[model samples]
Target: MNAEGLRERWATLTRCVCDGARLMVGQGNYDTYVAHIRKTHPDQQPMTPTEFFRERQNARFGVGGRGGFRCC
Candidate 1:
């Protein structure tokens, strides 16, 4: 393969690795959520990143009196 082909392949691999890492760490759901909103709720605007993070945190930790069971 040519040098340009190698560089392209390397870039693609690097991107995939980074995306996989983000997904493993729960930080990559924002894109998926945005896509879902666009597809399922075309009339509704998607939440901003900060808003989305807060919402996810609240859902996971039961913030604001939502009563998520705390083991600790």
Candidate 2:
């Protein structure tokens, strides 16, 4: 019921997503998860596999290509 508890619960539910596994719906509950994503990212278009992978990499660790880390 606390912040940590809530985060842990979310992490548990999203373990497969965190691990970069393609999403799989189970027990007809896929809509719930997709809805969660839509709610979180209301304005963003869904990314393709290449875009998603690139963005995911840049978000956490920052990627090399695509004008990353410009130094003047």
Candidate 3:
């Protein structure tokens, strides 16, 4: 959905009929948000020091994908 569609839906959910909190829960939708979180973590076997260093070097840094530049 577009930004307007998302905002419209958020508005609807946040408006209450009897003065109760419209945004009742912290998350907008339980299943959609939870499933999103579950999709990001990958399963792998534990790594040795050398292997761990290799993987760590390859991983992105900062908030997203800026990348790691320092050595241990």
Candidate 4:
């Protein structure tokens, strides 16, 4: 286990943990979303990070315009 090998393994583990955490939350998967847009709608562009975050937040909390889970 050299320094370089240890660094690579740590980076990989960090990436996996971050990805898993993202999935656990309501935030959408950026890579998968981009791939889907490229495959399905090649002409259209994908949402930017800010736009995507707002969209996800809106979907989860229904803050923007659309309605989400309501506990009335």
Most TM-score-accurate candidate: 4
Tell me the TM-score of model 1.
0.59
Better of 3 and 4 by TM-score: 4
Question: What value does the lDDT take at residue 46 in candidate 1?
Answer: 97
**What is candidate 1's lDDT per residue for 1-72, written digit by digit as tens?**
999999999999998898888655445568889999999999999999999987766665678888654667
TM-score for each model: 0.59, 0.30, 0.24, 0.66
**How far is 40's C-alpha from truth in model 1 (Å)?**
2.5
Better of 2 and 3 by TM-score: 2
lDDT of candidate 3 vs native? 0.46
Model number with the top lDDT: 4
Local accuracy of candidate 3 as per-residue lDDT tens digits, 1-72: 999999998887665432243123211333333455557544533455465444444542322455544334
Better of 1 and 4 by lDDT: 4
Evaluated against the true structure, the overall lDDT of model 2 is: 0.54
- Please give the CA lDDT of all the candidate structures: 0.81, 0.54, 0.46, 0.83
TM-score of 4: 0.66
Model 1 weakest 10-residue run by lDDT:
21-30
Off by over 4 Å in 2: 1-35, 64-72
For all candidates, the clash counts are 0, 0, 1, 0
Question: Residue 23 deviation, candidate 3, in Å?
Answer: 14
**lDDT by residue for model 4 over 38-68, one digit each (tens)?**
9999999999888887887678777765787
